[model samples]
Target: MLMNPRVLVIIPAFNEASNIESTVRAVVDAGYDYIVINDGSKDSTLDICRLNGINVLDLSQNLGIGGAVQAGHKYARHYGYDIDVQVDGDGQHDPKFIPLLVDEIVNGADLAIGSRFLSSTDGFKSTYLRRVGIKWLSFWLQLFTGRSIKDPTSGFRASGCRAIKLFCENYPDDYPEPESIATSLKAGLTVSEVPVRMRERQGGVSSIGGFSSVYYMIKVSLAISIACLTKRS
Candidate 1:
């Protein structure tokens, strides 16, 4: 057993055979406890995680992004981890930045969001609609929180127990990372964003690679807006 895993890294992987092992190794190398939530991947994802002896949480059925993340939160709470750092399965989030986020959280922030737009060295890629979507929600987010969030939708975020409790109890079922940020702020959690770089994917075209990308943008954007309206300020 690892000693007092203060930061619990949650990787919600769906068919990440090509990158899961490397990601788990990186988290181990970073010296933080991690849980790989295998969301019913049909590929070798679960096998690879098991072979590596990584801490894992398996689901009988695919629960989408929110469910996978909530599983990690429950595990962390049960195990008594103080913080939860969510890293994507496809290698988009760099493991090297884990310490920066953890340090910020330890210093008192309830959530440390790794923002690609906060520093001069970082960058963002995607279609015009996605960019527009980020900007549109970001506008309302700032208005609601009275703080300008450098990256509202980045999956590379770290949350503490207080924030994790809120999420596991009433998190949005889809496209949750962005919506959770707002919820975190409204619930009086201190949220900060630091500069971080992203890597390209390693295997399998994104489930949203084709025309589904447009549909994802529309759906998530609407979900974010609606969730914001109903959440308490």
Candidate 2:
């Protein structure tokens, strides 16, 4: 192993004022450094972070989830972090599973995704429609990369140095989680999935809701297909 690797937990928040403090506290309790990207939330997200004395990157305007996450990767690369873990600010991801993701990276995975379907113990598997969309994405990802991922759409993930560098250079701007996996594999990096328990969001609404799920499915499917055909850098 990676004896005492420098790990940074990147939490991207947008209008998650009600949940940011507890989320940061969970990461801190887990004994890891973390930074919250306040993606132009009109709510009191930034204020809560500041009040809690949490490290935060305050963006002036909304950049969506992908852009916010890309910013986190850039910070991880710039600050020389050995591992970067993406944890949602909505409290759905358990910080306890962070160590599992890090362990996979230590074992030589360039990217480690926290998968809910890897085991029966995972508390939540998301909505029925969401699960259907996730399964569709999983099929496409497997067909393209020749690798099967149980939770391709999971936001809770960790990236090694190589993966961080790749994302810093070029990251997907919309619906990134699944596409990023394909991109990393195409770039010849090792990716793995570790079983992790997840929970329903404690607060705030989902970014993808109602009919948007259909649009999200179509968009991410097309993106993965195109990514598979494109030549790797």
**Candidate number of the best TM-score:** 2
- TM-score for each candidate, following the candidate numbering: 0.89, 0.98
Per-residue C-alpha lDDT of model 2 across residues 123-209, encoded as one tens digit per residue:
989999889889989999999889999899999999999999999987888889999999999999999999999999999999899
The superposed Cα distance between candidate 1 and the true structure at residue 95, in angstroms, equals: 1.4
**Deviation in angstroms for 113 in model 1?**
0.6
Q: Candidate 1, 9: how far from true, in Å?
A: 0.8
Q: What is the lDDT of residue 15 in candidate 2?
A: 96
Residue-by-residue lDDT tens digits, candidate 1, 146-165: 77886787889888778888
Which residue pairs overlap in candidate 2's backbone? none
Worst window of 10 by summed lDDT in candidate 2: 224-233
The true-versus-predicted C-alpha distance at residue 50 of model 1, in Å, is 2.1
Instruction: Give per-model CA RMSD.
Output: 3.1, 1.0
